[model samples]
Target: MKTAMLNKYFNTPHESGLGKTLYQFNGLLVLTFFILTFLVWGGTGYSAGIMLLLSPLALFVKDRPLQITKEHYLIILAFSLMFVAHASAIYRGNSAAEITDLDQPMRFILIIPIFLYLKKVGFNQTWFWLGIYLAGLICGWQSIAYTAGEYGTRVSGPFNPIIWGDIGLVFCLVIGVKIHHLIKNKPQTLIPKYIELSTAAISLIAASIGVILSGSRGAWLTVILLALLFLTIAFVTLPKRISLAFTSVMIICSVLAYAYIPTVNVRINQVINELSSFELTSSNRSSTGLRLQMWYTSIIAFQESPIIGLGKSGLTELEKRLVNEDKINNWVVTESSQQHSDLFDMLAKSGALGVLILIFFYYSTMKAGSALIPPYSSTIVMTTLAYIGFGLTNTIFIGMNGTMFFLVFTVFTIVAGEREVTSK
Candidate 1:
């Protein structure tokens, strides 16, 4: 009887024919979604909407039986607690009407089921990496446009300024791996090989230019980290000869580029100056200083209501208080926004509980990812690390675009890695 039930669950029509086509189509759609996401929202709301829409389809088309692991249960429990805490805040009127206004919280709820379905379908590592490369290319083009002054002086691309930095940082990793892959391969045709190399080179150059043009000191630091990670991974994984050649080429190119490009030199120096001069206490220093103040304010708010805190719209209320106290600058403080730290924002809004859940969510995802490392594992590892690094400075996961990319790509990376192991 158990065997029969298992067969029934795995033997679904969706595994082939229309279902198979749909599955492949959805993969393509997922790729398109990532490209547009960076170009549109910079990784925020619209991206989440795309994932929400597909989650149900993924659920409906799934041929395999559902399997919930212990980690899955933990995540669900955490999310549920967050929901309950927010609901309590809403009931107590601790949150503003506007904070309770949108469907973001609801969307996160919907994401739970979708994420489960995606876990079942899994993904191919190659496809996942390809998607990242495509996203990098699109972002690269936008960066070039910004540098050419086709757009604003600042490199805003499709996403907001903050997200643009994150996108650029991720692209550096995506492009680096792709270039490495292209160089390693010797295609049958010279033309195709040349084309592949050219495309990879262009993409890398574009992303590099974009990173520089972004004027995001954090992002610049993030890209440098990404480059180092890439080199380290290659040194550890690849053959000695290949690693040496790749490292040599990279160093030579870097030296040549730096020696000739005055603009690049100027930008690097400017970033160094900004980083050196940055202060945590000075409100007048820059946004980083403001962020430090906000962090302090959030900690104080968290202490006031350590358990559940203020609610979903808690930050808005905190911002109002800060403004009234004249603690925040008039020119910078606004009616809608709060501090830039996502963790601190959660602490002020949802309290310690919410922050704990979020940290757990990221921790579990990373843990899952850690067990699935291999040929493609390094790429996933680097990309995920880059996302986390960027998140420290910017709120990349709260909005639909950011949330969608974060959840989808993260799940895809794990699924793909697992699939590879199982196949072996």
Candidate 2:
């Protein structure tokens, strides 16, 4: 009788009262972190809340044995390489400031403790998905509110429009996946299921609308590529009729958006115009033209230093030199900071070794995801794909917001997926 009372008082048989309180607090922090990620300026800073709670546990919690897996190691490797590659560049005199540029990569390393802490505490699926739902909901409304005009103007958050668009697109896909999982697993009569489904549907539509409003051409390409890949996966994993119907709906929506949305129409026409007019010799530097020129410049830099490539500042120095030599346009030197593409930027700045590290990181992550069960594995893989798609056009790791979004969620998904496996 005394034991039973004590257990009740403590909240759980396995944890002390304080432990239970901290665990619940961590759950709240998790949910809040996700919601604030897209809603406010410097919202990504909320990750510090989680890090504060987890970091102490990571350092002092010595009673329990941590079941660290190979997947965990791979995840760590992926993060660690971010630091190693950049540090090497600084050491090789590619960039100045030994510790300044290293801060972003160091953020990845700092996330390792949070990863272990979450693995120790286990995951709350409801908190995660519900947070995602609210994030997309608020992000959609905020993006719409930021809109000044309609046709040519873009909707941006506190960050770049491209970053906002890509993040919104990923949220839309994630919510779609959540809805699909609910449909497949939950009973139809459950009121909570319907509520979740309805909110997620609204989130999906609003986020998609926000992505369109951002006028990010890279995000549009990501949509096309991912849509095709996901439709193929749906055909393989879902009923044939369901896959066909979904594809049909997507196609109809795309056609309707192109025909009816003036922004989409104008953006598409702009890309076409830029492509036709762009020339390596001509000074026709539209947005697309600039990207093309920067890519060409990156290639030239890579050719000059194929082995180790130029260090962090090497690309900038080379661009100046090219301008002086009249080998490339002076516009490129003035307009661009780094190569817009992630791979090319690394190749130009860090060389083949850097590119190899990046590829290995992606490969390890995808392989780790592939080892997991259905829906959880699918979520990680989809998130990774979203990053890859966005990185094709933008330097995702260069910005704090983009880096935080990828690292925080990637670690969360991996740990959550592992919890699901262990729970079974």
Candidate 3:
């Protein structure tokens, strides 16, 4: 009986007046959410709330079944596993106060309904791309405005500098793919090819500039990675001369930034100096030193409880113990609560189980995204790569802004990609 109900629930499409109205409204919400995501504080959270609230209304339309598929299950299962992993860790640690941490994982689970709603409503891929382009422009201008103030060496949006720069860098990758799509497929009528091409090129430049000015060394590395990926793709798909020209431009830009941007130069030298001088017991206070120390401590914590791991309270208690035992510096614990890397944070707090779940989540995303057509597939894969890259040096999963941005953008791209595939 349950199987029958589920089959009935997943078979029908909403074609009624109310269904059409709900679909259009959801489309507008999605577009507006992306446009204001970087421009306003808590925008991603706000959008999440609205989507969760609105998704249930579809059930009121008689015979309006959810448009779910194997890909949707992959996404839903991945998120559900993340929640289970964290919940188990928290339960084992017996940390009632850390219950609030469940909120992030819960957001991922709630996205299951949003995915159904979006799949049924049927998004127009154009809106998604437009929102991305406009958002990139806003981020770029914000970066420029922040730099103009000369408040500090780095610039950012309303969010933290790392998250700000990371978003801009991802925008550069998405826009780069969009430009590639434009070049591959000529347009007709309303917008001239040259003008569209020029606008996209400008937006890509703006986003790159934003990433540079934000002064995140990790994001800078992502920029280099993106350039390499683009060059590789270009060589595979385009003429040799075009690929070489693009590579030369990237090299020139990198050189200019290194020479002219004090932040870039200083940061590069700081990393070199820190790496050369770093020792496990050196009481190093620099950013790189602190991260290395925290990572080492986290590994110790992981080793003690490899299964479910130590929950937040357990990790906190262990940190204090380590500090007292002189295994790690006091400054390491004082500087931040996180291990500065997503994998390490999970290992310390949730243990190997959490790390396994996180890996599964990433794998599921890539598996689901494999079906997307050209530029969209490349864009989705690159965005996923950016998250993995950023996670190496920073805790992308622990922060509200970073995690929310990843979840929201990931879902939007998946929905948009699916729609684009069906439309073709």
Candidate 4:
């Protein structure tokens, strides 16, 4: 009787409990940390910095598991080296010239530690997935609203125009998979089933609409890639009946999307027309000509400094000179623009060393991803492949939201590999 009373007293909220208090606070800390991450990117330095500072709470909790793997080390090495490369730019006398330039590399010091700590805590995979989906939904809704009256044209929401659409599309793909899973396992109870179906249906429609309104050809290409990946995975892993049902659903969705969504139809037609009429040397074509010019300049910059390459300072100087000489328009000039391509940008900024590190990183990740089997492996592989495909045309590492998304996904991939090994 005394022991029972003691147990009840200890567990009570008013009690100065040890384990209970710690558990409750730890849960709160985790929730707050994720919320901060979602809101604190995109130049929110104070908020981001505070979140990073608070991340150590996860590390401080006793008995918290750490799940670092060889794959994690390789991925961390790649990003760390890139951060070092950016910091090296400071030595080139660029640090004092541009506040924005200094901010990115300086901020890296803070971000790296936060990610390290998060990994140390064995952060919940489900929370990470939920965060991705929620971020996507918010961004997609805003994007659709922004482009509604723009006459079949798409505009970025809060993100920069060039890659916002791509980010949104990737988010949609992730969410779509989650929704499919929910639908597949929906409860037999009518109320729960209706709730699940209605929510999934609404989100699916919203995401599709957002993709169409964005009018990003690159994103459209990515969507196609996603479809192919999904079909391949479903066919290989699912029962024949389930696979056929999914295929039918996808086809119906596609048909309905094209027939009922005006923005989608118009955007599809636009993509077709652009591809059919594309030219290698068309100064009048904004997208193609601008990308070519950026590539040309980036190559020239790389040629000049093949070893360490021109740091941020050199790129800035080149942009200024190009602008003065009318070699390129000012709108194409980014604050920290290199080649829009991730690989080429590495070459331009960190020279051969950066390229080699990135190559090693991606190869290691792909190897790790390939080792896993079935649904999880397929999901990670497809998502990683999509990022790679998108990275060919867009540099994601420097962008605020893109970089965070990349880091989060990379961590999850490593965790997934760890889980697979443990399960075996």
Q: lDDT: which candidate is best?
A: 3
Best by TM-score: 2
Instruction: Report how far off residue 353 is in candidate 2 (Å).
Output: 1.9
User: Could you estimate the TM-score for every candidate?
Assistant: 0.71, 0.88, 0.87, 0.69
- What would the per-residue lDDT of candidate 1 be over residues 285-366, giving only the tens digit for each residue? 4555556666767776798778766664565566567767767644234523544666766676678776777677666665
Indicate the residue-level lDDT of 50 in model 2: 60
List clash counts for every candidate, in order. 9, 1, 0, 0
Tens digits of lDDT, candidate 2, 1-424 = 6675444333321244444455456667768877887777657658654664566654444433467778779878888987787666655664356556667667777887787776665445556676888888877788778864445457856777788888888788788877888889864232467777898899898888778888877888888889898798999999999999998999898899899987688889898999988776566667787788788888887898987778766777888887787666778878655678888878887788889888887777787787665566877778788888887888887777777787777776776566332211
Residue runs of model 2 more than 4 Å from their true location after superposition: 1-14, 49-54, 62-64, 149-152, 187-191, 231-249, 281-285, 420-424
In terms of TM-score, how similar is model 1 to the real structure?
Answer: 0.71
**Across residues 17-53, which tens digit of lDDT does each residue of candidate 4 receive?**
3323543443334344334432333522333344466
RMSD (Å) per prediction: 7.5, 4.3, 6.7, 6.7
Q: Which window of 10 residues has the lowest lDDT sum in candidate 3?
A: 5-14
